[model samples]
Target: MERERVNRKIAAIFAADVAGYSRLMGMDEEGTLARLKAHRRELVDPKIVEYYGRIVKTTGDGMLVEFPSVVDAVRCAVEVQRGMVERNAEVPQGTRIEFRVGITVGDIIIEGGDIFGDRVNVAARLEQLAEPGGICVSGRVQEDTQGRLEIAFEDAGERQLKNIARPVRVYRVRPSAAAATARPALTLPEKPSAAVLPFQNMSGDPEQEYFADGMVEEIITALSRFKSLFVIARNSSFTYKGKAVDIKQVGRELGVRYVLEGSVRKAANRVRITGQLIDATTGAHLWADRFDGALEDIFDLQDRVATSVVGAIAPKLEQAEIERSERKPIGNLDAYDCYLRGMASLYQWSKESNDEALRLLYRSIELDPAFVSAYGAAAWCYVWRKTQGWVANSAQDKIEAIRLARRAVELGKDDAAALSAGGITFAHIAGDLDGGAAFIERALVLNPNLAGAWLNSGWVRVWLGEPEVAIEHLARAMRLSPLDPILFRMQGAMASAHLFAGHYDEASAWAEKALRENPNLQQGLRVAAASHALAGRLEEAQKAVARIRQLDPDFRISNMQDRLPAVLRPQDFARYAEGLRKAGLPG
Candidate 1:
């Protein structure tokens, strides 16, 4: 293939960004955004057009411009700053939106309506150095603009900028001094927020539009239940239904951190829902998954799609937040930050990480005593310990776990994450099978879209000795979060449910699937051994038993009941023990 040619030119680059953008958003997000939009519409754009400047692209809080002459660029920057000063005259100094403009005359590469190269980088860095409502220029720009304009230049000495090979002298333009403080601006909600745009009907049938619109509405309603998230109302999200949207623009307009956009394709008896979660501010694709099912189960399909999408993206959003928190200075860490960090550790699925996660979670609770999710997650850490055999029948541990679970349930009556997590803790650690199942069922009622809740309910059903019911719940959970980080947990539960239901072949198959993802999962190994032995796969069963021995040398059939859920039916436990004996496990 012939390579596309490169384009380069010497241009005067103008870069400007809002000062203290984050703080401004935090203070009065809507008002700050409204003012910024008005400023751009009335002052900044007009000045740039008057100066013969070409607008390149705009980030959420910043814009880049190009001019043929450095003098024109400097003039535009000066006029914009002057206009801002006038606009802020009637506004409070603290809430005023201020622009910091940086002009540099340098070579840039242009392609596909975007400019690139080191000059662009320098302009951005220079913009960062400018004071609020002020203008800064490079030596070259200062030289070209000098005496060509009425603006006075203040000599800002040579400064070494990041990633720049050489220190470049800078000059500040003395536009009428405008006072702007590092106060608040329009910011996304502190809690993770999202908007679900209407899904396009790609079936080439106009009548299918309702199905697509209904999908978006259902998703918006379901996502609203995540008390940890701020979801845009259905009406607001539907406004962008058929429009070709810019994700960043949508994010700003809706004030959300993420946007979910997708399309629905239907053919006789079958429909497919495809969705992609995007980081609205940065336009990054965080996650994407598709669900395909029969059209006869239309409502159920919608519910499944909503649950799966929420289940998949919730963790992705949390992971994105964790990454953002990781970038903050250590001293700036807050309770939420600690909670995110703790969750990051908890997901590692190791003893040491679980311990660290518990410590951090408790620290979060200490920082904010009313943090319900922290209590729930801390309780989950205890559940993890027991499941991993790190703790066994410790009455004190069980009491502490129960205490945390109860507090979580009491405080977070409507929080699905808190409820589901607490439910799992109660069931697995405290052996309150009925109460645990009730908590999870309530969570499902509150947020039927929560995959984790479905997963928890499935396991509880298995312990309740309703193997067939457990299988259906587990299958639903899998459909809801096919790519979930804890997918192995769901798979292992399926294996157990199948083994108890006497589908030995299906049980072995699912056990293998679980072990494929988590080779050292003790539960998976035990299930694999039992299923394989019952299915007459003698060699495979013996090998799984050997591996289990390596993981827990003291393991024996006599004490297996301690490892399994205590509520397991007597006959189910006997069958499992018999299978293990057949697999050559010692009594």
Candidate 2:
């Protein structure tokens, strides 16, 4: 038998590499080579020596170093990145060099000055995962350097490093230059990006821990259905379940603009769920609320929490995105940029804006044919045309609207916006009420947090002759998004629901609310006129009728049958026509 000898020593390994080094070198080999050498000589070499790290080896685009202390390794990485930022200021944007660094602490086999084994590989893998001009470190390195350094570390969750045997917990080092340069700002997705952190289980009962985790996962799933949102996956967010985290750090680590954090307290048959939305860049609390409900309704609470967070953040996100687009230099906007501009136009709800919205959405689809959101929104523009009586050619426009709607549904079967918008278009423009309602129901199943789906469900119920159910669904929509941009739409739905149920005063009240938000909204005026007439407020009813006539002068009670396929439900047409006739509409 031969004696086996193994040499091992715990060491902190640091790996640094230039992001897109191959591309840079390919673009200008001579210039890139000269710059790399100069960087190592002027900035890199001095920092390594000052931190007391030994140079193990150097590749053309990367290097490996051994540090005796994790703190020193992190400090050296930070200083180098800051120096790179300053150096990059003198270069063209296209030729900028950004280095990514990774650090890890583990037992390694040191043959001479060079190191080998899993420890070294892990460091390299971490480097590859790091963002350009950023640092990534293993959980051990973060733990050791926690109190020893002045820098902050953001939890990046568990990462499955390529070829590594075990998963490594990762954190991002917040460099001082993060504030000095826009390079460190989160690269926001074309749409809003958000993360729902694991809920804090304040119940003190370990058994209910599962409940809290489930709540966050449900929220993530619900948010995922929104075509307008880029939601962080559940696996990544749950990594911070038991950790004390900084919201801005989470935002940077996740590369999202908003963060939703909450706590769950369960005791016996009751539970309390509290949530708050934060703007990661400014550390501002965008929204906050709490829900108290029965334990059996825990699932509903989860859905509500998800809905509330999205509803609260969506308008803010949209306004911010719109402002961003408005400020962008002209002629280089991509598909998403056009889409955001279209959204801003559509929300204005004027005839000129409606045309502009349609044009921009069409341009967006032309830019990226696979953009599901643009198609859905484009189809929705036609729905607006029909509702507002702005159609230049009903026959031709209907054909085009149907084509766009069908395409949206096919491309975005899993997206709540597509499903809901396509369904409503089919229901309103194509008069396939049943088929459209089925799609809306599927959208709700895909994402119960979708406030629009709930509101649409209410309208679908009314069209199907289920007025009470319509009211109930609308109430749910309101609770989920008390501050939604579509609140006026929900109010109009509620008004229609009450009107069909013969609750004249209630209908009038809701219609009034809708009109207050959107005085020109056709549905609001129709419902208000009908409800006031049915309640014997003849003067008010006549005033509403006059206002509606200004928007749709050809309006007549008899035309309701052709205009509203929803009137097919039993006596629904008669009910609507009777009220309209009494309100002074032509019969």
lDDT of 1 by residue, 213-309 (tens): 7567556655666556666655456667678888976775666778899999989879898989899867999888888887655555556655655
* lDDT by residue for model 2 (21-129), tens: 9999899999999999988988898889989999999998899999998888998898788778767875988798899999999899977767999989999999998
**Regions more than 4 Å wrong, model 1:** 1-333
TM-score of candidate 2 to 2 decimals = 0.47
Tell how far residue 496 is off in model 2, in angstroms: 0.4
TM-score (C-alpha, index-matched) for candidate 1: 0.48
TM-scores of the candidates are: 0.48, 0.47
lDDT of 1 at 570: 86
Backbone clashes in model 2, listed as residue pairs:
none
The C-alpha lDDT values of all candidates are 0.80, 0.81
Model 2 lowest lDDT segment of ten: 322-331
